[model samples]
Target: MPYSYEPHYFEDLDVGQTFESAGRTVTETDFAMHSMFTGDWTELHTNKEYSEDGPFGARIAQGPMTFILSTGLFQRTGIVERTVVAFLGMNYMDIPNPVFIGDTVSADFEVTEKRDLDSRDDAGLVVIDSEMTNQDGESVFAGDMKFLFKLKSDAE
Candidate 1:
């Protein structure tokens, strides 16, 4: 089934089309779980009361938590199931608004650039601008990511 539903080749990608996913609500478990992994023990993120007295007036997801969630949300698209060679990295990331616990979040993408790597005939580079938004349509995070994908020729 994975092979049957292989990802599109670089040439097959639609630059202007957006990719999106169902929203996932941030939860206390999400915060605690990620905090353990990242060592982000900020009171503003871990304590609801402490957060309520702070700027956003509620406990919010950590910036890195938002980043990780956004990536996980986007992965539900399974774009890499067929041809992804590697996840390059992210750039120009900003967590503009707080993402509070119970806030539902979703992610979408726009293709920013695509280019065939001269050094690799079987692979190419793809750049995407991704944004994570809350239920109210407020953007909580945004960034650019690059991917190296195996071309159809390489799949053979």
Candidate 2:
């Protein structure tokens, strides 16, 4: 069934409520593409033989790759389908664990703050505490992201 994208009001997102998104598996090509794009040929990610000597004992995806995958997973969450105005920026981004090829990744989010944009009557701002976890359910990345979106008509 086709789903109608409901416009979520800024005030409707409760502070403790959680939102999750679909997961994705990292692949060899993903590593290659990222390496090629950034010219990051660090053996830990691009050289299988060299990586074998590392803790993972195999070529692991670059930490930034996990960060990128996390963004894709975050987008799959329908939260952005609502009254999103714009993505402002991110803060405290960190990767605490190594993400390897074939490992799946997903995103979890909690609304941290919401405030009215005094100058813009139609929208407000929201800050979400976001975390990206690997298939093992370990938090690999975390940060806060800010967005601008339409305000709820009934919001105080």
Candidate 3:
């Protein structure tokens, strides 16, 4: 789905509430730019000719790039928008499949839990389960992400 543009406050999210994001095609630019930005020119990801003889038979995108694209697609869905306070952390991250260039990708997000902050009534903590897939519906990335969010009363 495309962007829905809702600023989700702490109270607005519920466990099991799910969201889907629009697709974005992974490109050579993505691989190259990520390689340039991170200085990760691992032969399997950067040297196509060398990768031709290696596993997967082609250069694959960086695992970090998959995470980046997945998160970017999630934000494109507009769920956080101006509602998010800060990203706390992630848990159990796994990259189960290779993300090749030209593969369109999207994210499926589910709110798994919510917790009240002991020090603040204006903010809360939330956990979301995320799965990223390619056009072929193969799992590329999966994780639980934690975030700090403003409560409804604290949202403007």
Candidate 4:
């Protein structure tokens, strides 16, 4: 069965609600583009020869790149496109494994908490526990993401 793509408002979300995104393969172009955009030319990420001698034995994606990719995967689910007001922040970001080129990855998210904003009738706060895993099932990134979401009553 196909996973239903449902539009969600702040009022529609509840603690323990979970979502998983489709996989995307990390590519050389992703590395190069990220490097060029961020001016992060670290040897381990940009130099294959240098990376070959490093602990991981090959070039690895930058930590921030993995986070970016995870966010992209989350957005691909289309759950937050129209309801999100702002990204409040992230906490406990941990990269437990390296993301190598050609490795496929996906993101999983679960609502951890929700709070109505006393000062803002239009929005509420939500914290989501996020994890990104590789094809091998090793976690490449994990964190708690907080966002401000528009309430259903206020979205009209």
Q: List per-candidate RMSD values in Å.
A: 3.3, 4.0, 1.4, 1.4
Tens-digit lDDT track of model 2 for 1-156: 111233456866666667777777888889999999989999989888899998989987777777777666656776667568788888668888888888888888788888887788887888888888888999888988888866767443
TM accuracy, model 1: 0.89
Question: Candidate 4 residues 1-156, lDDT tens each?
Answer: 122366678998899989888889999999999999999999999999999999999999999998899888878777788899999889779999999999999888899999998888999999989899999999999999899989999878
Best by lDDT: 4
How would you encode candidate 1's per-residue C-alpha lDDT over 1-156 as one tens digit per residue?
Answer: 111223566766656756776678888899899889889889998887788899888888888888889888767766767677788997789999988888999888877888888888888988878898999999999999888877877777
lDDT score of residue 103 within candidate 4 = 99
Q: What is the C-alpha lDDT of each candidate?
A: 0.81, 0.77, 0.88, 0.89
TM-score-based ranking = 4, 3, 1, 2
Cα deviation in Å at residue 16, candidate 4? 0.4
Model 3: per-residue lDDT, tens digit, 1-156? 345667788998899888888888888999999999999999999998999998899999888888888788778778788888888889788999999888999889999999999988788999989999998899999998898888988765
Clashing pairs in 2: none
Most accurate candidate by TM-score: 4
Report the C-alpha displacement of residue 145, candidate 1, in angstroms. Answer: 0.9
TM-score between candidate 3 and the true structure: 0.94
What TM-score, computed on C-alpha atoms, does each candidate reach? 0.89, 0.80, 0.94, 0.95
| Pairs in clash, predicted candidate 4 | none
- By the lDDT metric, which is better: model 3 or model 4? 4
List candidate 1 segments past 4 Å from native. 1-6
